[model samples]
Target: MEIQYLGHSAFKIKINNTLLITDPFLSDDPDLGIKFPKIEARIVTVSHNHHDHNGVAAVSGNPFIIRTPGEYEVSGINIFGYATFHDEKEGKERGRNTIYLIEGEKMNVCHLGDLGHVLENELVEMLGEVDVLLIPVGGTYTLDAVKATEVVRQIEPKIVIPMHYFHPKFKFKLNPVENFVKEMGVGVPEKTDKLKLSKDKLPQETKLVIMEAS
Candidate 1:
């Protein structure tokens, strides 16, 4: 499968003939201008109802969108959506969000959209082992660096991709990507514009892959 970073928490994953996009924030990010290419997909998975995560209208073609929390199977992909609170204090204000686990072609991909806090034991158990983890590391709207690192430890994914941080286009007051990278002291990170991975190419140890927005 190939993964392309589309700024903020958006990611396009291509597996075989299936193209899945997560939390597509395709517009002028409020803080940053157009940082990534404006592209459409065959399927769009939204984690929550937030503006950044639910910008499905920006994408053309009117792809099949899975927004609510549930399990679904489409085009050989097994998708599991779990309901969770979007705040650290556990639903104190923001209410619930959906955490998605997509299984396809021997690979398990997890996207924690605007995940604001740590995962509970049940959630972790339900997630199982993930091959790739697309997570939010920016503080204001999601888990900060420290909390993100802890989430990684619990999930034990083979690959971790950080997102939702500050960029030149985003006009928010969130911290930069460096904050998350610096906190991952022992994580071996590779900077790239895109990434392609298969079941055989899965890393043995957890790796932090930083992709340029676009």
Candidate 2:
């Protein structure tokens, strides 16, 4: 499988013939100055109603959209969306967010969309094993570097990819990825445009991968 970062929390994941996209924030906006390259996907997963994470209309192709917490099977991929919150106040402040576990190509990829708090033991058990964890490290509306590192320890994924952090083009106020990198105390792998991963290539110890926004 291959994963391509599309800025912010958006990612394009390819497993065999099927392609999946998370948080389709493709349209150019004043807050985020980058315009995402056009790409078609078979599946699109939206975590919440926020414009940055729920721009499903911007994605091309008649994609299968997953917006709520549930179990779904699209093509050959298995997806489980666990109900989470966008704030620590149990959605009282930011509403509900879905944490998606996508199972395909003998690998499980977990995308924590705008997660605002650390996972409880029950939710951790429900998540099972996560090979790749895509988590938000930007503060303001989501988990900051400190909280993001805590979440990383909770899930214990083989590969960690931080998202939703402040970028040079991002106008929003948020923590930079460096804060998370320092907190994690892990070496930063050279940033790549796309990450080519396989089940065999997974590291035994958690490895941090930085992907350049495509």
Q: Which candidate wins on lDDT?
A: 2
Model 1: which residue pairs collide? 30-171, 31-169, 31-170, 31-171, 32-169, 32-170, 33-169
lDDT of 1 by residue, 9-98 (tens): 888898887788998764655645664466767889999887777888777767889998889988888899988878977778787789
TM-score of 2: 0.97
Instruction: Quote each prediction's TM-score.
Output: 0.94, 0.97
lDDT of each prediction vs. the true structure? 0.85, 0.91
lDDT of 1: 0.85
TM-score of 1: 0.94
What is the C-alpha lDDT profile of model 2 across 16-61, one tens digit per residue? 9789999987566678888866888899999998888888877889
